[model samples]
Target: MATWISIEGHRRLVEIIPNEVQELWDKWEIRGLILVSLVSQLILIVLGNRRRYKPNICTRALVWSTYLLADWVAAVAMGAISSNLGEYYENNHKKFSKYYINPQLLAFWAPFFLMHLGGPDTITAYALEDNELWLRHLVGLLSQTALTLYIIIMSWKGNWLSHLTIAMLIVGIIKYAERTWSLYCGSIQHLRDSFLRTIDTSKKIEQQQESNNDGMNFWEFLANSIQKDFENEERRAGDPRNYLRAIYIFVSLFADMVLSPWDITQDRKELHDRGCFHWSTYFTLVNNELKLMYDVFYTKAFANYGIQGLISRLVTLITTIVVLASYCKLSENKEHQVVDQIITYLLLVGALLAELSSFFFAVFSRWTRHYFRLRGSATFCCILGCIIDCFFTKSRVHISMGQSSFFTIICNKSLIIKGNFFPVNKLEKLSSVSHRLTSEHVLQKVYRSLYDKSERSLQSNLSGVPGYRSLLLEKNKPIFASEVEFHRTIITWHIVTDLCYHFYDEPSYHFDPRKNSKEMSDYMFFLLVKQRQMLPVGAGLITLRDTVIEAKRVFEDINVVTQEDNLGEACRKLLERSTTIPRNEDLRMQSTSILLHACDITNELIADAGEYRLPMWDFVEELWVQIISYAGAQCRVDMHAHQLRRGPEFLSHVWLLQAHLGLLDQFQIIPH
Candidate 1:
């Protein structure tokens, strides 16, 4: 053990040492690159896996930068090494060249660059568009493979190191191929095609089974058949391995098919009515299932499946270990530089550790346990599944306040849009408003300005407010006549919700939904102005800019110059001064007072629900959920497609969820 530590310490020190006294050059470029590649692999493996656990902009950007740099650094290293060869050949040809150093080690290192290009399995594509670059990657695979091969042949003679290089080249090609193929499978078109094939095979088998059993009444036969089919599908959905495949089946079947809300409800009627799970358990299960869907569309998960992928990974791991062992054994006769030797060892060790981590992640994965269970391997299933269950239980127990809200917002955001008070103070403050945002008056004054502008259609055309000619609405028509109309409703109700909350007098009446409601409302507005491409066509940003300008002018007139942090206290003081402003006050000030009065009218409307009365927020929460879900479904698929260049937007996921729920009109099956 002492001797081993001494050798390891020597290897560490050699990494920073110069190769030769006469040559002033440190020969550190290749060493620096190898370290960068190793670091990149570790960063991606750790960060990429955590992405699904938290969906924030900062985390997304971190993963995005690391992912792109992984490939870029490795590719650039290859170009550098290739350039070094020209210099290597020139220096060695000089007859009196005592300073010309042999570059066999550099050439030997080329194959590892190909291995780095393979990337970690934790992430293949940062976004949907990355998968579309599979063809370009394929071209890269061929070009880089040839370049590495050429480097090895021209620079190194057939020695023991040459044999090791060949071994590494084989492993590198396999790794690169796996990544390219994974990218192909992750592509939306490829997934859709795979789904079609699975459906066709299932139908053929079902037809054969039905032909063998006959002589029953049509209704009796149909009912029994449907029951059996549902049971089979339910069992499949219950298993982690099959659940993803099952999702693909439904997604492919319904991508362009249409059905109504009632149809979707009826389809899931049996599961809801007779399933063993409660609503919360069912919600957890669906979330897990959708997470798999997210991976299929956005990551290299689909490529990691099947018997072939398992064998390829196993071979790559074994070959990497073999190469490391071979190099150490052969190093006894070689005069290799200390830094170069350390880099080779680091590359090999990094590969071994990365592969091991991936294996552990897979073994304890829900998919692995389900696979074992389906195959009747009770002992393995119980052990691995127990470990996974315990891990998740501990994770849930450690949930912090912020993580709780973050996850809740992600799962529920796609479900609804409600009229909640989204305070501007919580986020960016108006440059014009000197007061902190805790007061109703701050928002009320702004809403009042919007209300007046809305009445005269100044903001209507700005946000593309729907102009319906008829007074009566048709059955099954959208509740909001236009996208702009829905936008106005959102603004109006936001102010109302805030005022009602502030004026309610009872300190004990606070609810979680009401608190969370403001978050959702603010986030939606954030998406509206900032992520407008994800929503329907509108001039929301322009209108919002106009509102900000007018609100700033109002702030200057009121002479209420308070810092943003003090706005809450300012609002409390304002409310205490008078419930009704003086009649001689500016119309804008009166608008603030009138909007507060409107909140009273809203409170009265909800106070009269019959026995078993619902809280005002309960209705508000449900209403917004439906409204947001509707708006999500209303966005164009083209818009969703365009934004795939960035990471998957929450709005796109909601759009897909609406399609799964049969809420979209695009579900009608097209004839061939």
Candidate 2:
């Protein structure tokens, strides 16, 4: 009897609580949702741009959450307002007047929701995939516009406030339309189609010119022109604006559109002649081009260009200001509820502030600078350029590479919990606790390696590895690094790199090739383990898992602790274990464990370095670059485009650089 009574009372309490909550929601739902929507917009405006360079999980999550919720919240608020309008009409239009807030104030709030649907100027799509959903947004635009119009029509008072509502509605629709158009243009199919059209037109012009010209082709003529331009030393000093223009021409390549031989030749000559072949200038050009591409793919920067964008901005600004002023004049009567007036004032002030901020971003944007320069608006471009130099001098690209260590993952104990019997290595690729800045020395070395390979025409080979065999032979190693499977090669090299990194004493060189090699090894391993989708299909995870399981057993026998000082000793002991048995390729391949293979490679590298009297770390560094570039070139084109939405990947930069250098297979030279 006591249990039954208690259960019945508990059920009654559950039933009573929802009734009270429902009653409260019905009263304050519209006001609460509106305020929340406003807060979301403010958050997006402040935090959206940070995702480009600062790709920490916290920032991405907050920005992504706000971006998604900003739309949903505004749509829901509009629905609530529509429902309220329906109720007011159902009650013979007398109920809202009896309520504390006027129905017209509720109707005024609907336009604010429409503006929120437009989103902030900083971000449009969170990922590349979001751009593909333009039709859904178009559908949303029509439905939401209809719903908002219905709300305004039902609650029309034909006063100054009504006129203000109509004006704000116009601004809201314009903003939403711009976002939809941006998505449409940014879509891959549309982008590719536009590029094809441009290419077709250029092809026709080139054919006409070829018939009129001497025996020299269009590319040869362009190359000569570029050589002449290079005579002016001032032009060779890299300009950021040049990269902005290059993006317009080369962005189609990222969309998987083919470039003609003449196009590649012209681009290569321009880049080489302009001193962009140097490491620093090359990376700067690539980084700036990528940032511009990011703006095109994911921001309103593309839509807010040219005369139409300017007119839209002007009209939206004027209309919003006019409406705000009209509302201020109308508010003088003070006959409405205090809460209603306050909400209306907040929406107006928020809209005005958002517009001003958007305008500020637009005027100082790289796109705007490029536009004014093209249009010969020198004064505007010069002034804006000066302001940017003075205030925004920080490098926009984050040049740091993420590092994940296989040894660290194997030794980490926290990854293994009691309930989970899974391998600790498979729990999660250990979070990158550290990052290495892409030093200029490494960049120069990589640039030289790729340039040398391109000159030798080695990049045209579609079989085996690109630069692996030649680099290995230079060290007197008869074995091909590609003898093993690609994934196994990565695992073996990574482990070998780690062992060598710990076993050798720190070199006194100013630019330590050991450190560079270690960073590339860890970064490639990080991609294999964490970002596998960006790489070619392989059993990298399985290879890594099997290798980690074997290493875990070795660590258990050695009773190792994962401290800095003890890591070297642990590596020394592991090396001793592997070297104890004679190296055998059959044994290495038969076993899933790559630790032995890594040991064999390490011994070979040490032996070859001693025999050749060469810096092993130097060869190691170049070999890793070859591996990375191979992966970068072979990676799917769309994957590189997809990664741009996240922080810029070094691999993508390399891929773009290779394409620009005419090193990729995509740039086939068709004979005239």
Query: Which candidate should be chosen as best, given TM-score against the real structure?
Result: 2
How well is each residue in 79-104 modelled by candidate 2, as lDDT tens digits? 88888878877877665443446777
Give the least accurate 10-residue stretch of model 2, judged by summed lDDT.
216-225
Give the C-alpha lDDT of model 1. Answer: 0.53
TM for candidate 1 is 0.70
Model 2 vs. true fold: TM: 0.89
Q: Against the true structure, what is each candidate's TM-score?
A: 0.70, 0.89
Q: Write the per-residue lDDT of candidate 1 for residues 1-672, one digit (tens) a residue.
A: 011123565655323433363233324555677788789888888877666554456777878888888888888888877776777676565631443335677777787788778877777777667878899999999999999988887777889888888888998888788789878876767655654454444445456454643333212232233334455644532444334333432345323323333324434443334345433333234345445555555554544543345567678778888888888887853585555567778888888887776656655566555544444468987797678878853321111111011112212223222332233332222211111122232122222322333235311332122222121032132432222345545544454444344444334235644554444455455556445566666544443433333333333445544343344443344344334434355554423323333333344533543432335555544444444555666676645554543433445444554443333445432223
Candidates' C-alpha lDDT: 0.53, 0.74
Best by lDDT: 2
- Report the error of model 2 at residue 649, Å: 0.7
How accurate locally is residue 325 in candidate 2, as Cα lDDT from 0 to 100? 89
